[model samples]
Target: MSGELRIIPVTGLAEIEEGDDLAELVAAKLELENGDVLVLAQKIVSKSEGRVIALAGIEPSEEAREIAGDDEDPRRIEVILREAARVVRVRPPLVIAETTHGFICASAGVDASNAPEPEMLVLLPHDPDASARRIRDRIRELTGREVAVLVTDSFGRPWRQGTIDVALGASGLEVMRDLRGTRDPVGYELHSTMIAVADEIASAAELVMGKLDGVPAAVVRGLEVAGDGRALDLVIPEERDLFR
Candidate 1:
């Protein structure tokens, strides 16, 4: 049988004050097997990690007013700074960033949407890989089965305006599948042929997870991948960055 994509809505899971047995919660809801993968949105994890703040209480700094720069939304600027401290690089309206994850992104991935509590904001997890490991371990303890867990966050491409999901942290899955030295259809040797299988997997899960829906967790099965907690290895840096 082929692999499956099961997008399960996590209802009443909003006030996630602490990390739960995510893998087990997802597995039990989906009746997963040993090889299943759990794809979770970073928002819930951030909330659980106390990464959320009541934005209403946060005052916009003078720097934030300057950053806003005729945008006329001081709150947006403050939110951006709180999400990202110290701008790494900027180009007029757009500010490319060195996010807290060390991942470069626009707006530092500080999203304002889907905040369950009014006047509240969400931030990304401090260490997504560690969070992923914890969830994986908890799942293993609960079900006595080892499974892969992927911490996913929505990110915009450098030149692209739209957002797609990316794998921020992962375990029990290989981030890249190098096909170098492999033969092609014409018997030509392949070179520089590492597939970013991890990001692709994350994007696929996001297709079902959706941006506007309450369904934040997706159960992905049928894909066989080796996880080594090397999600960052897949991140293409600048000079190496196609957008730069």
Candidate 2:
């Protein structure tokens, strides 16, 4: 960890669309450097990957209709269900589900905000880790700089109010910092201490890329925590999950 860190927001990107070259677009706007951590919002990645869905095209099933009730649109619920592997909890309009990517999030990461059009929804990337890798690889090709890329999304924590940005996908970085055998300053040997470094970096990046700012990307500089790790490294195994 570096004593000085910098989070530079990458702005001026036009509204992303399906089939757009996201890596190229970002590279044109920012001058990236080697060892820089490029943090990207999930919405832009989803948009570029053509993951947006039109509500009018969705046909709600009986289960989706039942879950949506009369207050919410069944079409939206159907989209959420389609992306979710299993429903974790159902409370009226709020559906906590496990996404097919093994992420436990609200509505399986189906979001209506920042959509390209009205009555449309944006879905999480089918393979977020792959998405990150593609962007990272392209950036390297374009700028000849080896920068780490992280796809980030806002997630609500259990028993916590408000949401924080978390790493949905990662490339070229060690997502976790394990200190199991390291000794603390007090000379106490640590047995089980692991830090979610990727998530922390995502949250730090989000401090500059606000929700309404239209800034979808940021570069984290001066962090000496680059290596090989995926966002999956942060996921708790179902067998080890105490809440499940």
Candidate 3:
């Protein structure tokens, strides 16, 4: 841990499109330094990966229509269904699904907000961890500085009311901090103490990049928590999941 930490919001990025060089775009706007953690909103990563879908092109299926009922757009439901690996729970106009990536989230990370145009939806990146690594590597190539990258998305907690940003993917940093077997300040051995460091950084960076702020990236300066870790390390295995 460092004595001081800084979160700097990156601004002035144009609407990202497929094949856009995100690392170049970001490096041009902000000067990155070694050991900095660059947290990027998932939408921009999706957009750059051509993950945007046009609702007009989607046709609602029978199951999708049944889920939509009358309050929601069947087209949107179809998109959600396509992205979901398993539908956990269904309430009209709301769905809790488990994505193919093993992430449990609402609407399977299919969001319509912040889309480039009307009737369009943004999807989660196909492989968020790979996306993070690509950006991190490109940033190093452009700026010659070693840095970490985290791809983040907003998710609602089952017991909580509002949404918070969480790391969907990570590269060049420790995604978790396990304190098991370590002695506490009171000489008590920790048995089950693990921290989702990537998620915490994502949430902190979100403070500067709001949902409607159009800011897609932020730099977290400080913290010597670099390591070779992936976001998949944070996923609870099905056999160990108590909620399932």
Candidate 4:
């Protein structure tokens, strides 16, 4: 019999801060097992690592001022500029940036919602894949149970309304399943079929961990994938960017 998939949210976590033991905090709340995948919201991970930045500390440059126009905050634009590898588009309230890590998002993933202070903004992890590995290793060391970890952030799709969680970092699981050269059930040779499993897991977990529900982490059980895969594998390189 196929195992039933379960997405269980772990609640009751205290507010995270820089230098906090995220693995310890998560383990204390959830009992993880082998084959389980822990999906963590990028916000909590950013908080735990002290990625929060004070808007007051930022000094907007002339370029930042020119991009922000009159109504938007220049300091926020400064932060986004610093985080972005390239500015894709600038339309005042919406600055689309390709992050240094190759993520294309609005405001370079510099978020202000749910910050510790009203004057603070949370930035993405300096190295999200490394962060996922650290969390996975720590959880394994503490519980003796092997599992995967995935960091997720919400992103808007082109031409699509609203947003959903997507994988920013991952460890100990296959992020993509490449099915090229395989034969289909109908006996036809399959080519160019790949699945982004990590992103799908993140999206599924988001169903329970809503935007304002205060849930930070969730356990995805019954997935059979086992490997040493990173979320970077999910990224489509610029050379292969059909949209570009």
Candidate 5:
């Protein structure tokens, strides 16, 4: 596949809410083929599963209050704290945390942007991998086509200046492609050349699914990748983690 990959954005999806059938919505909009990879924004998944919270409904803990300081909203901080396993870094603008799912992201993958209400906050889907699997299986049952699903969220990198989409959970797709021991063009052996395929697909799909465009899902085609792996495979083990 040397030409170009095709990314088709699934547009006109109504505002997702709790109990919405996301698999049906996506299957109705796009004609999925075998090996097609669907990348869905995490916000829609969170909304569909009622993972949103009203800041007014929460009470701040002492740790949350201390972590937030004076300007920040203590209730929001409390929610972040509840979602996080440990605080990675604390700054006025943001709080980076290691989520219970082993994901390191700002505010424990919580989001206020595009929230249904002004006082509401959207949190990452509880058990995102399970969510992905369910969605994938539903789509297959509906369309009778084998497909992959990836739950994605925009995340700020440590050294990078801007945000990019990354895979939070995946099903029926290979998250990483390890190319170690493979020979290069000149027959030279390669080592430690693992590629984050799910993240790449997520970021590429984002090019078509704008942040505020109301497009929640995208289909990535024309790539030749096959495996039975989970998004957890993308995480760096604690023992090998260089960055704390």
Candidate 6:
């Protein structure tokens, strides 16, 4: 048998709702195993609990006018972008920022897709790691099975042409599998084999979820977890980041 782990998108996950048992809802649709990880879109999680912000009433502030392009500054768009962004990218028209929870993403990871109205956009949950932890705990509580959970959001890469999904928050899973001192199939000691497993899973899951497919959840099975508990420590911080 092949040893490679595979993640598959769980289709038809129906829209998530606030106060909904997220774990139970996910577990019901698919048969899960011990090492399987659940990849959840931050958008859906934000939506289900009525986190979608109606921008119609929001007014743009001085920061918004300065941040949002002069031509692109609609009052509502500015408000949502402002609240979501921790840092702003000034060179490009987009807001490349550290999120409230410290995820470095465009517009502080604020998204306009799947928004309720034409004039509205949605912001990510204030605390995604906490959000992931809650979901993981709830799933364990309801199904009595332990599994990893990751909240995902899309981000644009520097020096790259397109955007991709990335893990914003995760729990009950180790985000990275460090193989720094390990060896490859050959006897060569690996110095940089530490893999970002959670981000990889998020990207794979999005391949099936699609930007417009409305699919929000995906299952990754057969992979060995690095261990259990939250993986917020695995990510890099802005100050230490050399790429900025």
* C-alpha TM-score for every candidate: 0.85, 0.98, 0.98, 0.97, 0.97, 0.87
Q: Residues 1-244, candidate 4, lDDT per residue (tens digit)?
A: 1778999998998989999988999999978899899999999999999899999988999999988889989999999999999998878879989999989988999999989889899999998999999999999999998999999999988899999899999999999988889998899988788988888999999999997888989999998888888897788988999874
Scored by lDDT, model 3 comes in at 0.94
State which candidate, 3 or 6, has the greater TM-score: 3
Residues 1-68 of candidate 3: C-alpha lDDT, one tens digit per residue: 84799999999999999999999999999999899999999999999999999999899999999989
**Candidates by lDDT, descending order:** 3, 2, 4, 5, 6, 1
Single out the weakest 10-residue window by summed lDDT for candidate 5: 224-233
Question: Whole-model Cα lDDT per candidate?
Answer: 0.73, 0.94, 0.94, 0.91, 0.90, 0.74
After superposition, which runs of candidate 4 have C-alpha atoms over 4 Å from their true positions? none
lDDT tens digits by residue: candidate 6, 57-143: 777777667656666655644654566545556543566776556667766666677775676567787777788888888877877
**Cα TM-score of candidate 3:** 0.98
Q: Best candidate per lDDT, number?
A: 3
Q: Assess candidate 6 and give its TM-score to the true structure.
A: 0.87
Q: Is candidate 1 or candidate 2 better by lDDT?
A: 2
What are the candidates' C-alpha RMSDs? 2.9, 0.8, 0.8, 1.2, 1.1, 2.5
Candidate 2 global lDDT: 0.94
Candidate 4 RMSD to the correct structure = 1.2
lDDT of 1 at 45: 74
Candidate 5 Cα misplacement greater than 4 A, ranges: 1-3
lDDT by residue for model 1 over 1-244, one digit each (tens)?
2555554444333435655555655666656567777788888777767777676667889977776678545665677676675577765446656676678777676766776576667777888888888888888888887778888888777556798888988888888888999999999999889888778888888887787766778767777785585676766775687544
lDDT for model 4 comes to 0.91
TM-score, model 5 to reference: 0.97
What's the CA error at residue 202 for candidate 2, in Å?
Answer: 0.8
How well does candidate 5 score on lDDT at residue 155?
88
